[model samples]
Target: MLIARWIFDIDTIDGRSAADVQGAAPAVVLDESVRVVPGRDGEALAFDGRAQAVIPAAPQLVLSQVFGFALAFFVNVTAPPDGEWRGLLYKPVGENDARGVGMWLYPDAMRVRGQVFTAKGPDYVDSRTSLRVGEWTHVAFVADADGMYLYIDGRLDVGVPLEHEVVPPYGPIYLGGQPDRPGFTGLLDDLRVYASALDAGTVQALARPPS
Candidate 1:
């Protein structure tokens, strides 16, 4: 059975708010909530490239040992300016410090990127391939003792060390975008966060279209 710390699926979709399907954590749609659109599978939550969904900092997300974690989601690129970096998900730590780990799109590189932020420093990795615009693609960001891994369409795109252990960000997770970066303008579906790094096979299985 597929398991995850948090799963946000079609049942969680809302016009102005979203609730985790397997937990109590809820995310508030900010700045004029995005629209709901037919997803590559069942249903998806859409972002306007300017709006976001915020999940407050709580026990469900705040962990002391984030040694290994992976975030997976499906997206359809739509209207990001060429060469711009767009945020997919992030967690803010503080003002002086960069926000916590996040997933973003590097349009120029035509690939997805993963970033981790903590008091010690930050770590990042870029996916090897570009996202086919206007098409649904599955992406994941993973971090463990070995390193940070970026998966695109269920394939390992990048794998690099995540440096040493560092304090995790103590804050909420932002979906679609962050304050400093522009959010993705398109469809987002089947968002999930796992406590442990998922292997390539599991990730590939996740990429399978929902039934």
Candidate 2:
């Protein structure tokens, strides 16, 4: 089931925050540079690697065994410098780890990565193909009883075996950026979080452009 979604269609409460279309919680903008721009859907939020937002911790926002998230992104320019990992969505458990699940763009390797951090350590899968700069692309991360999967443009890019059940971190959800790391340099739209793992059909539906 869909637990939370953000379209950034409009700004409210004096433009200091963006409401989650699902009514879960508001994403409070941390920097004034975060702007509402035309998006893949109705409207999108633009992050300049310094703009970010925070959604307070909530029980319904955490995902465990079977869960998934999808979002549309458009890079503003060429990928970041090699070896630079830019944050997309992050929930840091402690100061050093993204304890629950995190999504990032690793332009250094020209790939995207999805991670699930268990008690033992973090396990991740990288997309087999490189990301296209300045193009809107749909990306998702899903985990089920079998393992974790990463999707690009509604297709399964790769999957990794699960060694342990996910251990969700007790932390606020960070959008666009996380602490001590650079933010995403692009436009983001239609971010959705689900309580259950999504199938290929559902992912494809999410990836499809409005006709």
Candidate 2 structure lDDT: 0.72
Residue-level lDDT tens digits of model 1 in 1-211: 2233233345765556666665555564545766766777666778887778777776556533354777888888887456677888887664335667878877565577787764467777877788877898989887776677888888898898755674566677888877757788888877787767788999999898766
Residue range 98-189, candidate 2, lDDT tens digits: 55778887757557888878768888888897777787888888888778888888888999888786776657777777777787788877
Model 2 is weakest, by summed lDDT over 10 consecutive residues, at: 69-78
TM-score of 2: 0.88
* Per-candidate clash tally: 1, 0
Report the Cα lDDT for residue 211, model 1.
Answer: 65
In model 2, the runs with Cα more than 4 Å from the true position are: 11-14, 28-30, 66-82, 94-98
Candidate 1 least-lDDT 10 residues: 1-10
lDDT comparing candidate 1 with the true structure = 0.72
| Whole-model lDDT values for every prediction | 0.72, 0.72
